[model samples]
Target: MRPPYFIPADRTIDYQLRYFQAKQLHQAVVIDNNSRAVGLITLEDILEELVGAIQDEHDFA
Candidate 1:
């Protein structure tokens, strides 16, 4: 995978959504500063993560 497609750890969720949508990438690889393959971040992965986060917040509330 292209390194430029890798997202920074600090990027906002909205930014990620737009980036992926504009790039037309269904998935991306998560890399560290050392340029190592940390994990995979797909569209489904982000969506699930977002959903889980929202549910967690709701549960806490």
Candidate 2:
């Protein structure tokens, strides 16, 4: 099992990306001020947040 990455809610998006890149992190558990997980963010979610939308040419059934 892989350990989840962690990020404080106050951290900037750039910091989160740096941590993700440096650690090769895939998933992150966002923590509150008390150090409790409040949300989860994944690589895919970050990409989507950054890029907005991506349309694929491949057909899906």
Candidate 3:
């Protein structure tokens, strides 16, 4: 697989998702204030998160 995609930790969730989808990155690195790696997020992880969020919204509705 390609090297982990890197995204700034401070980026908004919407921007991060758009950027990752645009680059077709399988995974991403959430870089921190000191430019240190804080976490790794995969495409599958993103999808799962989205699904969970949708379910939550649906429940609330």
Candidate 4:
């Protein structure tokens, strides 16, 4: 599989959400100042981070 999309920590939630959907991306490696992965951000995590919700096909509207 290809690497997940990377975004800066300061990125807006809307941008991240759109990126996650358009790319069908499940996870990303959050990088730090030295251009190294410092943490991971999964779709599940993003959903939780944004709306405190969980994503599932049945929940799509």
Which order, best to worst by TM-score? 2, 3, 4, 1
Per-residue lDDT of model 2, residues 1-61, tens digit only = 8877789989877788888899999888999999999999877667766887555575354
On TM-score, who's better, 2 or 3? 2
| lDDT tens digits, residue span 1-61, model 1 | 5544787666677777888999988887777777787876777667776776434443665
Q: List the residue pairs that clash in candidate 4.
A: none
lDDT-better candidate, 1 vs 3: 3
Best candidate (score: TM-score): 2
RMSD of each: 6.6, 3.3, 5.8, 5.1
Top candidate on lDDT is 2
lDDT of 4 by residue, 8-60 (tens): 66667787788889988888777776778778777787778777887578686
Give me the overall lDDT of model 2: 0.82
Q: Which stretches of candidate 1 lie over 4 Å from their true place?
A: 1-4, 52-61
Which model, 1 or 4, shows the larger lDDT? 4
Q: Which stretches of candidate 2 lie over 4 Å from their true place?
A: 55-61
TM-score of each: 0.60, 0.75, 0.67, 0.65
Instruction: TM-score for candidate 4, please give it.
Output: 0.65
Tens digit per residue, CA lDDT, model 3, 1-61: 5766788888876787798889978788889989899998776667676665434444665
Clash number for model 4?
0
| Shift of residue 28 alpha carbon in model 1, Å | 0.5
Candidate order (lDDT): 2, 3, 4, 1
Q: Provide the overall lDDT of each model, using Cα atoms, as 2-decimal numbers.
A: 0.73, 0.82, 0.77, 0.76
